[model samples]
Structures are given as structure tokens and as C-alpha cells.
Target: MTEGETPAQVGASSVDIKDVDVIAPNFKKRLSGVTSTIVQLVPYQMKLGIRIATLGPGLPAYLPHIRWTGLFGLWRPPVGRRHRIWHARRNNEMLAGLILKYVLSMPLKLIFTSAAQRHHSSYTRWLIRRMDAVAATNSRSGGFLQVEHTVIRHGVDLDLFHPPQAQDDTIAATGLPGTLLVGCFGRVRHQKGTDLFVKAMIELLPQYPDWTAVISGRITPENKGFADSLKAGIAKAGLERRIVFLGEVDDIRPWYRRLDLYVAPSRNEGFGLTPLEAMASQTAVVASDAGAYAEMIVEGETGACVPAGDYGALRDAICTYLAAPSLAALHGKAGLRHARDTFALENEARSLNRLYEALIG
Candidate 1:
């Protein structure tokens, strides 16, 4: 199966189920960071001529994916290959792969990608120990793993997210009210430090009338009150007009390109990708040292980094960029160069492909 080949089409066609080279499983319905990574990477891998297909649900129907019923087909050896690589990102997926390889006696080489920045649970550790190979998203995440693993940092699609050719026109098209736009994106929740970004903005936006802040993401039902409280604070500060919350835009690349500066105030993350995405868009970043953010940003050159949950440091960093617009431009250009040179999506896909080949060989 390839992109645009639906499950129905796959069923109707003469495509052989035994030819899949890799299986990337989702398992969960909600769109999570892991799902996003799989969605972004699989297409590139397919273009590279890797026979990859996503399993499980919640992904776009158009993505190259096999039906859940395809699990039985794993019992047979893939044509021209001794075994298929089952790449699992979550414990449940690892467990399923284990069952297929062990109980069903399928010829599958199980590989796992670990992105969690903290210690794993006992069960997860056990599952990790059983994997044929493990890949961590960063050096810090590798430190948390009990087993030996390779560090493969995530990358962004540079073509989809590039420097804006016309900055003023891009901002105007967003319909956001500001000559200078600073954006904080991700889920609107306390753990993500959305409140901290709001607090920092409340203090800074009032002083700089030319600057406005935008928070774009989904606020889940449980976090409705938290979002409302932040809105209330903005109202109380009398800067409601200065700050805007454009809840979860489908295309966030433009939001990144239009920003004068981008903030990733996550208190916790599993290898945060927002800062890299922002840098790919040629936007300078001010991010907390969460996930692999400290590793991603070249402080003072690309962007600044602060201690997680330290709103004072965050405010100071944002203030420095706001005070010196020239500095922000320099950082943005440097960040763009850094991202393009180091973090292209093809680099990541090729690295993973090599690793997959080594395991299978």
C-alpha cells in the first residue's frame, strides 16, 4: 500500500500483504505526538522506496496503511525479505509485536523507539529489554533507557515549513492584530506550561503595544477551565485585544512563519518537536529545557533556553528578543541555517532506514 491507497482500495487491488517491509502501529485513537511522528515520517519513508505501512487507527485514511486484519499475514515471510521490521513506539505496540513474533512464531524483527525523557515503568522496561534494537530520540532520553540504544533525534519537513518570503503579507493574512507576533503553540494545559506563556505574555505585551501573542492549540474538555482562567487573566490585565487564542489551526506552518518569535513553554515532553518546527520555519525560539529542547536550540545564536517552569527566565528571554528586533532577526536566520543543515526530515528517514537494514541483515 502507498499514499492515497485506502483500506477498501487495498482490499480490492491485487497488492500482496506479504510484501510490507515495515509496520508502524498507532494503537491509540487520539492524535498524539507519536502518531504525528509516524504520520510525517512514513510518507517520506515511502517516497524513499521503503515498503512501509501504518497499522492500527486514528491516522488519516489516505496514508499508506494495512487493515487491522493484516496481522495474520505477518505469519508468512515477506517476499524478498527474511523478516519484516515491526517498529513500535509504545509499550502496547511492543507487546503486540512480541505476541506476533513469539506466540504466533512470525518472522518479524521487533524494533522500538523510545522518546520518554523519564524512567519507564517496570512493564515498559521489560518490554524494552525484549526488543531486538532500541532507538532513542535524544541523548537525554537514551540515558533513561536501561538497555543499549542508538540516539536518533527527530527532524522537521523543511519544505513544508520554510522562511516566509513576505513576512508582512503572511501576518496580515492570518488576520491577527499585531505588527510583531509572538506565538506559543501546543496543547493548552498546565503540564505544557501554557499558563506560564500566558503569564509571561501578560507582563510583556502590556509594555510593548506593538507586540501581540497568539496561543494556537486544542484545549481538551478537562482543560477548559484552565483556558478560561488564562483568558480571564488577559481580560483582567486589560490586554484581551493584544492576545489571541486561535484554537488548533489545521495548518500551523503559516503560524510559525508569521511569528517574530516562537515559544515552547513545555514543562514536560517526549522529545518536543515544536522548537525544531519553529526553527525550520526560520522563527527564533525561546523554549524551556524540556524533552530535547536544550539539545535542539543553539542558545544565543538560534534561540534562548530557560529552566522548565521558570516563567521569570522565560519572560527575560522573550524580553531580550522583543527589545532587540535586530537580534531576533539574526537568531532567526541562524536558526534557519542550523535547521536546514542538520534537521531535514530525509536525514532522519535515511538514518532510520539504515538502522532497519542493519537489524534485518
Candidate 2:
């Protein structure tokens, strides 16, 4: 199955129960980072002969999946294999794996991937302890894990995000104001540091009239007031036309290519991917030291990293590019090379397949 296939055409029934070697469970209903990871990686893993299938709802039809009723078939091992690997990324999925392996006495090996940098709760620790294997999305996540785990950082789809054919043409297509564009994308909330980016732009954009700042992300109902306040601040700064809010975009790849610089001022993250995505788009980045931002960036080469939540540092970082846009192009070239050689999705898929194969063996 591939993109744009209908559910009827790529239904779970089409995939044989005996062929599945790994079950990647996504218990969440809403779209999230975890869901995005599964959607992006599964097709690659399948191409690499991992025989993995998702076991949950809310996923796209392009993925190989097992229906909820298919859980009954777990009583029998897949083909000649002794057991299947149950890979979980959430607490509830971990519980489901535990029940499948222990409660039901199924032929399964449980593996959990952790991305949180914070220490685990007792309940979460309990789940990790019972897993047959664990993987962390980054070094910081591994540090927070109680069990031994492999550090397999997430990777970006290079095909989806690459350097623009013509930077000026891409920027013109956006129809946004200004010759140079800097962007901060994600949820518009305090934790994401949307206000910090806004405040920094409010202070910097007037001085550097050649640049425009763009923010693109979802604004939930609860955070409407927060988004409103930021807009109010932009209005008060008299830079409303200069600093624009793009809300949530359908495809952010073109937007990344349009950018001369990208700022990811997130106060916190569970292995942020925007910096790498920007790098893949041949755009330089200025990101806070959150999630795997530090791990991904080459620091001063691809871009710069500052202490998370530091407005002074963020403003200074953006000002560096605004003062000398040529520097952004230089760094952006380096960023594209780094992203291609280091953070390609194929690398991540192979690393994960090795781990899954080892567990199955």
C-alpha cells in the first residue's frame, strides 16, 4: 500500500496474518508525532522486508494493518516464526502489549520506544521494566530511561523536503511579504514558546525591514486566547504586516524551502523534527536546546542552538541572519549536506529493522 490508496483497496484483510513479524501499535485517536512517525516509517520498513503492520485506528489506509478482531489470531505465531514483536510508543499501547504477551500467553516480544526527556513515573517505569527491549529517540531520552535501550533518533523524509528548485520562485509562490522569510512552526502554545518567537520578531523585524517572520501551526480552542494575545502584541508593535501568522499549513515542505532561516523556539519537545526538516529543505535553523535539536544541529555550521526559553538568545540568533542574509545561504548549504548524510529516513528505517530483527531472532 502507498499514499492515496483507499481503505477498501488496502484494507487490513488484504495483509496475511502469517506475514506480520512486528506489530506497531498506535492507540491514540488523534494525529500526533507518534502517528506521523508510524505513517512515515512503516512503508520504508515494509520496503526493507520488515513485514511490520500497524494495529490500531486513525492511521492512513496506505499502512499495512490488522483489524481489532485480528487480535484473536495472536494465539498462533506468524508462519515459521516463534513469535512476533509488539512495538509500543504509548502507555496504553504498552499495557496492551503486556496483556497480549503475559495475560494471554501469546507468542510475542514486547518493545517500547521512549522519546520523553523527563524521568518516568512509577507506572511508566513498571511498563519499561517488563519490556523485552527498549529504544530511545535520542540520548536525552535514553538518560531518562530506567532500562538499557538503543538510541535511534528519528529521521526526515528527504524526498518530501529538499532544496527549492528556485528560492526566489518558492518565496514568490507563498505570496507572503518580504524578501527573506524566517519561520517558527508547531502548536501555538506556551510550551512551544510561540510567544517567545513572537516577542523576538516584534523586537527585531522593524529594525530589519528586509525580513518577515512567519508562524504556522494549529491553534486549539483553548489556545485561541493565547494566539489572540500574540496577534495583539504584533498589532501593538505595528508590525502586523511584517510578522504574519499562517495558521496550520497542509504541506509545510514548500514553506520550508521558501525560508532563508527557520527558528524552532520550542520550550520543550519530544524529539523535535523541524530543525532537521528545515535542514533537509536547505534552510538554516536557529533552534532552542530542546528535544534532539542539539543532537541534530552542527552548531554554527548548519545553524545555532540557544538555551531553551531565552528570548535574548533567540532574538540575537535571528538577528544574526537578518543582519547578514548571505550567512543563512552559506549555513543552509551546510545544513542540506548534514541532513542528507546524517538524518535521512532510510538510515532510521534500517536501524529500526535491525533492532526488530534482533528481537525476533
Best TM-score among the predictions, by candidate number: 2
The 10 consecutive residues of candidate 1 with the worst lDDT sum are 6-15
| Cα misplacement distance, residue 308 of candidate 2 (Å) | 0.5
Checking candidate 2 for backbone clashes, the offending pairs are none
lDDT of each: 0.87, 0.89
Kindly list the per-residue Cα lDDT of model 1 for residues 1-361, writing each as its tens digit.
Answer: 6533323323322235687889888999998999999877877787787888888878876567777778879888788899999999999999999999999899999999999999899999999999999999999999999899999989997766788877442677766677788999999999999999999998888788778899999999999999999999999999887889999997787789898899999999999899999998888999999999999999999999999999899999999998887888889999999999988888889999999999776
Candidate 1's displacement at residue 53, Å, is 0.8
**Steric clashes per prediction:** 0, 0
Best by lDDT: 2
lDDT (tens digit, per residue) of candidate 2 on 1-361: 5543333234433366678899999998888999989887787787687888888888876678888888899989998799999999999999999999999999999999999999899999999999999999999999999788999989988867889887443666777777888989998999999999999998888888888889999999999999999999999888888889998888787889999999999999999889999999999999999999999999899999999999999889989999999999999999999999999988999999889889777
Q: CA shift at 146, candidate 2, in angstroms?
A: 1.2
List the RMSD of every prediction in angstroms: 3.2, 2.5
